[model samples]
Target: MKKTTLLILLLFSLKSIGQQSKLKITIDERIETLYSVAFFNDYFLINNHENLYKNTLKNKLNILKNHKAVQLFDSLSTKYNFSYYRTVEWILQYSNFPEFNKTKNKADDYSTVSENKQFLLEEFKDELIKFNQDTLFQKYLKAVKPLNAKIISQVQNSTTIDELPSYLEEYYGKKLNSYNLILSPLLHAGGFNSEIINENGEKEVYALLGPNGEIDFVPYFDKDFIETDLILHEFGHSFVNPLMVKYENHVESLSSKYFTKELEKNGTNQGYSEWKYIFNELLLRATTIQITRQKFGNEKAEKLLNFEKSVGFELVENIVEILKEYELNRHKYVTFDEFYPILIERMK
Candidate 1:
């Protein structure tokens, strides 16, 4: 690793908040504003000025050090919405966007499906209470509820129109028609995936909306996927998003040393990292396939991996560019070692 990267490693390695690492620093100005402190134990948001808040954080950090709460807390983050982060995020956005605060303290971290949107909101308050008791689902409270309309009205809390186009125009024989098929992205900040909905001239899309606040795309999931796994594969990014956020600075500065041949042998192949962009994207897709299989099941995992190979390296690299441009990329287990097989496996 480079000297600059090494500095980051040494900083976060400490258990105590010793020198306060800049591991979370990045060039993405928008993202920096969304920062929050995560209690390593419960993997929940620890950002707030309330006394109860600091008390909760201290208690959790103590448990984290003892390794006693790891299982329950880990389960909350790993399987569910991992809302801790998003909650912290939403609140920061919330304080700035007054509309979201209208929901009172009774609101819990639960979801409810309904025919009438207004009735759903009313029923949700009741469900949120039950959700918090689960220890498992409570983590998603921040992400579970919808954004206050007033909050969403602000440009900061919303996304671009094309960022997630609900319709696509595909060539089908001799005519052109509107297809509900689409891509739904729901990673940390959303816009994380693509899908082809099987809506027979209708709209049918869905969002992951994991129990933890870490995964909630309901806002954008106004349609359904033609095939379930196709969207899930993309939603898989939610699980992978935290891991990547764990390395936020790494990618922000990836370009700094990304394509440099500085570490290569005197004169040989493509340098320290060969195949560069192709290799990078191949790994991203591989990680997505692997993690989704592990979490949801292998049902369509293998097939998706096969699809990558068929897509060929060039096309895959182009796709990667799109992902990178949209700031939607991640690795499976949040480590460099795990990133290799994922990168190479996608090579056709």
Candidate 2:
């Protein structure tokens, strides 16, 4: 009886670990608070779901809109190119307000921040904390708590989140410490991702995603949106970006030949102004197509491939073909990094 009980306990422990290994989908309070401030400051006014917040948190927005920190954020955004993912990345570096200490360090492989901007963040730290305290940001978070819970529940119930970690690990040949899929209602349709490399060299990747639609004023996430493509593309960056950096010279040489003026204009409009950015996007989009093909089949993959071409990644289908070669000859290449040179060579 004792031996049988021990075996059962061991099985349960292993099951728990297995469940933990899957991607976690939830809303981040820190992100909610940060974007609330940005929304009040009129930063993301162009694409943000302004009516959702305006209808839901009218009283809180009325009070917090005039806060000193919101004013500072508005001023800084006007003074510099401080918009979009840069603002989100900066907020993710800090602890939840009140303490608001730097959670990320220089050694961390996160977003790039200019020295002047870094100084400004340091200068603004105290006021940020004060804004959270005085404006009762926690109350604002509380108001949206039900919506947050609903969004998380909707995503977590999807099969795609369960499958993503294993798929990413199998393709990239590296395991991340964790995958955090954060639901950010304040963001526009686009998503942002970044990696935090700990001192122990373990990587925790984060994807800040927005709602696909809304029901009444509450943010809604359809299963289709939570499926492989959106989340996969974001998480793919953590794997592909580093490899691009490693082979930067080769990528740079090939950029001028492939990254044409029309492509450049389209890419810049989408915030991928640099060649390296376009390169990363191409590789990631191509990989997503491959992943879709493997998981769903060829028709869906073809659809995605054509969609990418329409959006300016004309080279994506070619990259997808190369990735197929890598997939078929995994014993020879072993990892995507090992097979990366072949991609560069093929581009040449």
Residues 1-348, model 2: lDDT tens digits:
999999999999999987774677778767766676777776653334544555555564577677777777776677756666666677766777578877664324543446666666665567677766764665666667776777677777765668888888888888777888888877766688866654566666888888766777667666655565688889888888878889999999997788899989888976789988888898898998888788868887888888787887788878887887899999998888899999899889
Local distance difference test values of all predictions, in order: 0.31, 0.75
Error of 2 at 297 (Å): 2.8
Candidate 2 TM-score to native: 0.91
Instruction: Report the C-alpha displacement of residue 204, candidate 1, in angstroms.
Output: 5.2
Cα-based lDDT at residue 104, candidate 2: 68
Q: Model 1 — TM-score against the truth?
A: 0.23
Among all windows of 10 consecutive residues in model 1, the one with the lowest summed lDDT is 167-176
Error of 2 at 205 (Å): 1.5
lDDT of 1 by residue, 157-200 (tens): 32322222121110000111221222211222222221222224
